[model samples]
Target: MELALSLGDTPKPFSLLDHHSGSQQQKMKDLGFCMGLGSTRNLEDLHIKNMMREKDDEKVISCSSSSDPSSSPPPLPLQLDLLPFSPVLKSPPPPPPPSLSHRPFPWLSKNLIVESGSQSKLVKVIDAKPLTTVSDGEELAAGEYSSPNNSNSGTSSFQMDFSSIFNGGRSFNSRKRDLELSVNLELVDATERDHRACSRGGGGMSDEDENGLTRKKLRLTKEQSAFLEDSFKEHNTLNPKQKQALAKQLNLRPRQVEVWFQNRRARTKLKQTEVDCEYLKRCCETLTEENRRLQKELQELRALKTNQPYYMQMPATTLTMCPSCERVATTTTSTTTTSPCQQAPPTGSHGL
Candidate 1:
């Protein structure tokens, strides 16, 4: 009985199973998961997946908060020293450009002569200068294109080449005596071609005087004049081809034909102007005659208007002398006497 009671306090197999099973199950749950839902990842993969999820959540929060522009501070500047080790990148200093005098180019590119495979210069400016020669001057003016450095040759290679212009030649801004290299260098060559030679090229201008000048033809032949007149009737102006054809047919030069046509046009214009002047004169005379006639008519009308009452009062019959007052008087009717003074002769004896 005692043994049974002691054992009763101690675990029985059936009761032990119940408590142990429950406790073991709780312990197992605390320790690790049970059968997975459907995961295919290992510990490392699952940890990575969890980290990615957390990063996505953080990104979502950041994006949502980013709407308030003032809320976010600017991103911190990247410190180069803090960055990973690299080739320690740095820009190299630029190489100096080649100078003009050191390697001379063609003075005039048009005159470049290619012999076999190499190029040679037909004409070039003197490289040497008056002072320490070209070498000293080149060193002083050695610059990338044009620079502040000025030498005896000028500013740049261009100024140096054209030193004959502003610096070498006569300029308003005169330089020091030692700097003037081009005192009186001629810029333009004299024209050697003769004007008479050009004039002698025409076919009709073959006749020359002792002075080597072509003789002027003052008159044209009757046949030539007639032909030119017919041509003038056809067209006032002539094209180059037509002029050439006309010259060939008339045994004349193109210049002569052209001048003749120009003269003919001038004459025609003058004749037309004269005819117009004559017509205008005739019109003026006709207008003057009409104006005179109209003026006479107007004068007659004005005089008739001024003397209208006289015509109404008097008749064109006869004139008489008044015996009473000795004054001339007019009558209205042709049958009445001309003299009829208003004053009665002694009033009572007026009828006598």
Candidate 2:
């Protein structure tokens, strides 16, 4: 369970707008050192209180003018009266102090890199002042920022300038791409081989001894390999007993198995997301091409339909000559006359 509370109960930034001097004249700025990103409701409460005080003052002024001087009761004492105020001499008021706890720059992440493996493998940003460092010279190493108790990396609490991590000719983006390619390739290859091996039945020894006992060579430490192989075989969430059994088989602690499962789930999800994204991309391209082709076809059809030639009346048929009688046929009955070859039936036919 992740808790949102910070160590030191620092009062969140409370903006005291001097309504007396100017309302919009003063710029609002964040105040106070961040224990984390921004202070909690404690800071919000103070802001509300200040706003109420200003509203009360405004109400007092408005009510006072409308009241009868003779019968109206004395003005109520204001909460602002109890608060101390220093009189400014002749100097211009100091620039509105920047809010130390203003909503952190929107683009910046509130998380500190607790453990940046090939990817940001394990991240915990519980503190308010989320482990930011000044300038670009102090980027923390891969193992320098987790809890001190972590067995893998002993010293885990180091302040580092995150910007420096992206510096030195090679950018974080490039490094991230390289890391992604490496992890992705490793995971894909492992998964594919494991799938292929498992689908081919148990990838163990084939031959048997004289006693009919088959000797199998171990590919990994008994426990470690079993844990991995079992993970590939099984589906659904593992219970404590199953986890322990798996851990024992793989020669690892239960915690290591749990973490491995967690990381594996994350990696699989990421890969799936990438695949889904690629599929969507291809789908979009196909749709776009189809749309373009349809549009072209529609345009061509439209042009063909719109640019059709106007209909013209056909001329009356007039035969210029007759083949059988060798005379011009003035009327349009050219089919009524025929040559001897056309009029004669075949020799086998009986035509009188």
Candidate 3:
């Protein structure tokens, strides 16, 4: 006897044979997926057999459009038809699948655009200036230096010669970022130490190093580099105060801390977006399951009502399971009568 197929029933595996133009037709007579002239007419079945075609076309298009003309598209695979033991059965409408949430990250450009004929036109406005060599105990730049005449300090202004800060220097140059970072570290340390000690702390330090005559390249260990990267993810865009505190904790310079935080913030925002997407996906799945269950219950109730007699004058409540017996029975003014509709015995348990 032929086994009848229903919605969601799995079909027996069958062989797929393929025949096409410009290719020798081959017979796939084994029990595998079939795709050709007389295959299962079910759209889903056909889709399964021809799945490779979808991917194959993409490769063909990409090959045809290649910059080199020697590249040729591969020959299409032949279709196979699986013989069915019985007539094709109509399938039930499938529950709509939940859509997945796609999370995309913002991309940062790694390439820097250098303008033509203007490589040296832009001045590097960073660590080039010496932080320690400022005249007197007060070595503040024009923008950074506040008036000593302010009520906070209540002192007269003194001329701190800053002309030497960039004196005898090339007009515009781009040193390696690491070298600039080293300069920033030395200047911030020397200035901060001197401010606290109230004494010039340049006794052992060389004048050339202080005067930017010699630039030192700084390097970080693997562990230090990894730690800084992790730290920056927690704190983004630190100010002077925050930078100092972070540097104290990490034993790194404020400049290094600042750069790390900048990079970290960008990464954190991207990570947060991905996390949000996963959460939304779980929520979508939960909602989908709930919707499916509710739809199934509604269909069952509708089926039960349709089978009832039209003149029975049974209330809709009769369609519900009995409170005590948990059976589909209708209560009337005269008496409660159990319908021909019988609920499946609660699994293995028989009625009392």
Cα error, candidate 1, residue 9 (Å): 99
Per-candidate alpha-carbon RMSD to the true structure? 56.6, 36.4, 25.2
Ranking by lDDT: 1, 3, 2
As for lDDT, the candidate ahead, 1 or 2, is 1
Residue 186's lDDT within candidate 2 is 41
Which lDDT values do the candidates have, in the order given?
A: 0.32, 0.30, 0.31
Candidate 3 lDDT: 0.31
Per-residue lDDT tens digits of candidate 1, residues 1-352? 0000011011122111121235543432232211111111133322111111110111100001011111113122110111111111122322222221121122111112233346322221322211111123222222212222333133123222212111112211222221121111211110011122223332122233334365534345343565566555445567776676555444345666789999987776555445434543554465467569979999998799687877656555444434343333444454544323334345442332
The worst-scoring run of ten residues by lDDT in candidate 2 lies at: 58-67
Give lDDT: candidate 1, residue 330.
48
Question: What stretches of model 1 exceed 4 Å from their correct place?
Answer: 1-207, 310-352
**TM-score for predicted model 1 compared with the true structure:** 0.30
Maximum-TM-score candidate: 1
lDDT of 2: 0.30
For model 1, name the residue pairs that clash: none
Tell me the tens digit of each residue's lDDT in model 2 across 1-352.
Answer: 0001111112332222212123221211111111111112233322222122110111110101111111113223111111111111123222322221111111011122333554333122322221212122221221123324445223222222222211121122432343344333443443344334333332211112334355332132222343253343332245665565444323234554566667655564455345434543554465467569979999997687667643123233454433322233344333343323334555532221
TM-score of 2: 0.26
Model 2 residue 138 CA deviation (Å) reads 36
Q: Which stretches of candidate 2 lie over 4 Å from their true place?
A: 1-226, 309-352
Residue 234 in candidate 3, Cα distance off native in Å: 7.2
The estimated TM-scores of all candidates read 0.30, 0.26, 0.27
